[model samples]
Target chain A: MDERQLKRLLTEIAHEEIPDDMNVWHEIRQQVETANSRTTRRGFRLVRTGLLAALFVLATAVAYAVYQGLIGSDPGLDAVNQANLVTTIEETQELGGDYDWAVTLHYAYADANRITVGYTVTGAAPARDQLRPFTNTLLRDSTGRQYTWLPVGGGGGGGGGGSSDPDALVPFEDNIGASFDASIIDDAPESLDLTLTIQLAYATEDARQEFGPDVMLPAGDVTFEFTVPFIAGHRYDGPQTASASAIDMTLQDVVVAPSLTRLDLCFAAPPSDNGKPWAAFADVTVDGNVVVEDFQLLSPIVPVADSDCQQYVMPLSLVEYVESGEWTLTIAALRAPDTESPDTVIQRMRDEAGINITPLEDGGYMFSEPLPEDMTAASAALADILSEEQQTLEGPWVFQWRFE
Target chain B: MASLVERYQVHAARVAYLITQDRSQAEDVVQAAFLRAYRSIDGFDPRRPFQPWFMRIVVNQALQTVQRDRRELSLDGDRQAGDPSFMLHDPGPTLESIAEQTELKQQVRQALKALAPEERAAVVMRYYLDFTEREIAAALERPAGTVKWRLHEARKQLRTLLGETEAEEG
Candidate 1:
């Protein structure tokens, strides 16, 4: 067939396959409205905070005490509270049915970049090989923009079994408490009127086992609407420059929020005669306490839009409230990716570490078996090589800022 | 925004469906792409046409979803069960012309199934979306030369899969 005929045929197939009635604007609108509401409420809160602070202090304290249970055992939420950045969300809903299920929205913390919400699900565990409780959450602001929950570790959802069996049912806990973190893409408002919708459905283990279509329980959605005032943070936009190992680096922006700290650093690209990719790494400390953990030096290196220098945004999650004191970001080293190919890396791991690594089709490597306890160090070294941290230029190029 | 969705949803969904070969997933990819476009509208330059930027998001999201589904399938160790080509839309109406059209669609679907997702995307953009090679490159974030190569390879594969020789250019 000619190009024209193929085009006509493809168009016809598409038109026939996708009906004209298919529209997803309703879903889009739901998410958009939630996001917009947060912006509006944040503006409103900023305008009213000065006038209402004195009158609301006592009432807010009492509410805080009542809602303190919701933030149970989450280090991040506890840090937000310690930083005085948390807003209590004392709302609960009952799923009124055969199963006495209840959901509570405990508390929320929002900074300029991220929002974290703690919640709890109190219900009976599902009977083995029967129905299982499935909880889906949708978070939105007053205006209707939805925020996707950040996956903790590699997977999303609060709790699930790690069994490899297809028929293995995840044993549900009576009181399942979890926290959801979502990064705000747009500029976060000073105050947000957030609405979180939690829908509960009981899914069967398998359709083939049940010999029928999957069933959805009659339990409806439980929604909690609350206002969370963002904890004030500091932003340093002045150019802070330091040079080490003949490489000049500048700290363009540093935003220290209750939720997280973000650093924007610009540096001159190291000479690459061999066409190898290089990246920068930093060690951040607040009052002599190291704040950055598991700093992945490679991946996500973006070039500054209007400048020759490359920029990287490093987000650090503080486990504890950062006290008002000295803060330092030391550009410790510049590292380049390993010059060897994937095959070479795999071969080296097998030869030196005696670890069999399989390269997946998606450009990732997997261990053939779980590493022995003694092999963890070797595995870490292998990871560094795979991540391309071969050559290194060491420097303690430091940039300091005071938060008071 | 509604008007924009109305104008682009069918084509965007069609491209996503053609690439992913799953109706429900295509719908989801289109919705997510529209939401992303809406959220990032402030970053968009007004002087440029919106279609390419929006289409780029749809294509990228579709590609990511396909990759993620593949990863999940690999982890689950049941690769054959969730193959998406089997989940193409229902057959068309029973009239003579409609039956012929349905047969043609089946042939096209089978032919498309032979190409990789990236090749399918390139072909859809080039033929159905009428995107130029440069435009396709910009949308896919690949070099123009790479886009040309993909299109050439995809057309050759499709010709072989569909069992038809190229006719003279109009």
Candidate 2:
């Protein structure tokens, strides 16, 4: 078209006016103004500072984030202390008896909050020949600055033990630890230097002479004054050796009827070569008499030779399987078929010769299986097995749960 | 509302002058831009150098105003209607050519108004103001690609507008 017209149009386009009103700009500017004015960690935006300054600022922000990242692992877990553990134990002993003993154990499994303790009281330990099942009243308590608890119950267990005779011979293997809870005196005068005195209210002189002075009473009550360093943390793991109880039964005989079942363990070498039994023989004593005089652990419980006789058959020993690197570790508790008593039968046996015959509840024992003589050689083997296989007991449970 | 006097009016005026052909409208656009700038001061980054930033704001402000007022922006509109000389062209030197040239100046004013705000802004900043692509981006708070595309598009639109005007006169 006309070049003259194009030039004129271009000239006209150049002169346009801007209006005066629109204002929200001031508010937006102020938001950024404060951050810019301070001598902030974020340095000044240089005059054409280039990409370098911006990159540096970004780097600094990332570095600070990384440093804080590595340092926050145990923020709230460190709050648990020794005092809270002790106070918890001291608060729950003897149903407020004037001379009650409170024992609190503060242990950590991942430093989590709360610890539980269960305590049981039974009539008495059964004598060696008599299969009197031990009666247990279990109570549990939580360990903390404050002690909370559940009431006592008679029957329930991870496992239980019993016998045919009224006097059931109790062994350390059958022994159940202090219950999860205890009935304690809230106002009992506490002892920093505490002495927990336990007396046998109605135990025979024979039992007292055999176990401890605490066995002298009608019913033996073992009062444990957890030594000043008696700190109980972690759950009560039912390993006889793993958990140690300090008792003041010095003059009195000390018999711990913990229904412990020793595993059938053997050295890779023969008994003669290792100069030891497959397992050490342990004297299973009840109220006062030894129930299992001394039994040798021949082998770990494996498949039954005849599953047909499962009703009354003994179990294979865990000792044998452990030595062989394999064995069935099933521990079942069954109540006595004859009597409706709380006692159950727990058999630890293998398909092979060695069978560990023990009761799980408060009654009934099959008298057909005779007791073995000084199986001390087996005890020696068991001691080694304990050293090698102790970690096994650190898990699950070796004791019975107290069901109402 | 307190008489929006721009703290950076001078720089804004310079920006308007560089982009616009009419000095009078440049002054007016700059003032409007300053009023907008003054109102937006609170939103401004005080840490930044105020001049370039304010220039960017003024350019956008003026472009928008031009787009909104087309009659005030053009050349031929001002000449009286029905006057044959005002409408026609003389192939030689004549009173109509002189009047038409004055009308051309007026047309320039109007053409600015005719442009879409963004194109007017690009043409104003790119050619009239001679600002580099990077500076225009900062002013528009846009990427360089966006600024370049806008400038290209504005130039094409202006060329077409100019072509139409030439065709009308011929």
Off by over 4 Å in 2: A1-404, B1-49, B63-107
User: Each model: TM-score of chain B?
Assistant: 0.73, 0.53
lDDT of model 2 at residue A100?
25
lDDT of 1 by residue, A68-105 (tens): 21111233333466666667776788875655678777
Which digits, one per residue and each the tens of the lDDT, describe model 2 over residues A306-359? 321111111111111112221122221111111221121222221222433322
In model 1, the runs with Cα more than 4 Å from the true position are A1-78, A81-91, A96-102, A121-136, A141-192, A199-220, A240-251, A265-280, A285-294, A297-340, A350-356, A368-370, A374-379, A387-400, B1-170
Task: Put down candidate 2 lDDT per residue, B28-72, tens digits, no spaces.
Answer: 766555444432332233334556655666776666555566666
The native-contact fraction of candidate 1 is: 0.32
Where is the poorest 10-residue window by lDDT in model 1 chain B? B161-170
What's the lDDT for residue B75 in model 2?
52
lDDT of 1 at B122: 91
